[model samples]
Target: MSASSLKLRMMIVTALFAAIIGVLAQVTIPLPLVPITGQTLAIGLAATILGWRYGTLSILLYLALGAIGVPVFAQMSAGVGILFGPTGGYLFSFIPTALCIGLYLEKTSFNLKNAIIANIIGMFISLLLGTVWLKYIAELSWGAAFASGVAPFLIVGLIKAVLAAWIGIMVRQRLASANLLYA
Candidate 1:
């Protein structure tokens, strides 16, 4: 493919992933402070499959859609308020989460092991950042933040990480084999 066509393909894929993130955001198990949503899983998948550049682009696109009131955020929430709300830290953290996950795979290899490691790291990053945000925004004590934000999500996050790694590697391999993804 020509450079232009490749760029177009990447853009299309990025947009598609953004939409996927939005769709997955609705898969929520509600909680008091922040619900457990499939957003992180989608983030992991994007990073593992798309690498740093496109993965981060997809996250940025997703954020932009939500900021514009597209109702793409968790529980179909949207607008700039959500970006600045109590759960906003998690949303903001997705950028670095995706970047780190994708970069790790790009630096090492896009395999299930590396993807799992990367996603686990991404999970911690999100938890840490989101907890801090929740603490201040929600006026909760650090203990409360840890209890609600970090503690509850650990096991679930690990499960999602593994799933993302497994599924992402499979899909990535297929895409590469089909000449749909560049190395």
Candidate 2:
């Protein structure tokens, strides 16, 4: 495809990823400690596949949609008030996460094991930021914040990262076959 067409494809992919995450937020795991959402998978895969700019744009678009009260946040909640919730840690960290994942995946040579490791690290960065944010905003200490925000998501995050890496590998293979990737 032409350069302009590729850019258009990236734009469409970004918008679609944002919408996918918005939808995923509605289907929650509903943990007693802190609710878990499928958004992590969407964010991870979006970053891993789209690269930095598109990944960041996808997250920004999701934020914009939620800000407009699209019921895109977890449990069908949205608007500015969503920031006041304890889960806002995870919510707000979505932006940094995409950039981190994009940078890591884009820079590193991706093998199955390495990609999974990188995926976990990237997800952990988001979870760490989220847990820290939860600490101050939720008035909990580091331990308590981790319990509430980070702990509950650990297993799910691992599982999601595995899936994201799997999808990413598949996409990479497809793109490679089409001779559409840079390296």
Backbone clashes in model 1: 0
lDDT for each residue of candidate 1 in 58-98, tens digit (9 for 90 to 100): 99999999999899999889999999999999999999999
lDDT of 2 by residue, 1-183 (tens): 687876776677679889989898888888764678888888877777776678889999998888888988888889877765667777778888888777877787655665687678878987998888778877898888878888778898999999987887677667656655433
Worst 10 residues of 1 by lDDT: 174-183
Off by over 4 Å in 2: 175-183
The C-alpha lDDT values of all candidates are 0.94, 0.79
Q: CA lDDT of 40 in candidate 1?
A: 96
Considering every candidate listed, which one attains the maximal TM-score?
1
The weakest ten consecutive residues by lDDT in model 2 span: 174-183
Taking every candidate in turn, the Cα RMSD to the unseen true structure, in Å, is: 0.7, 2.1
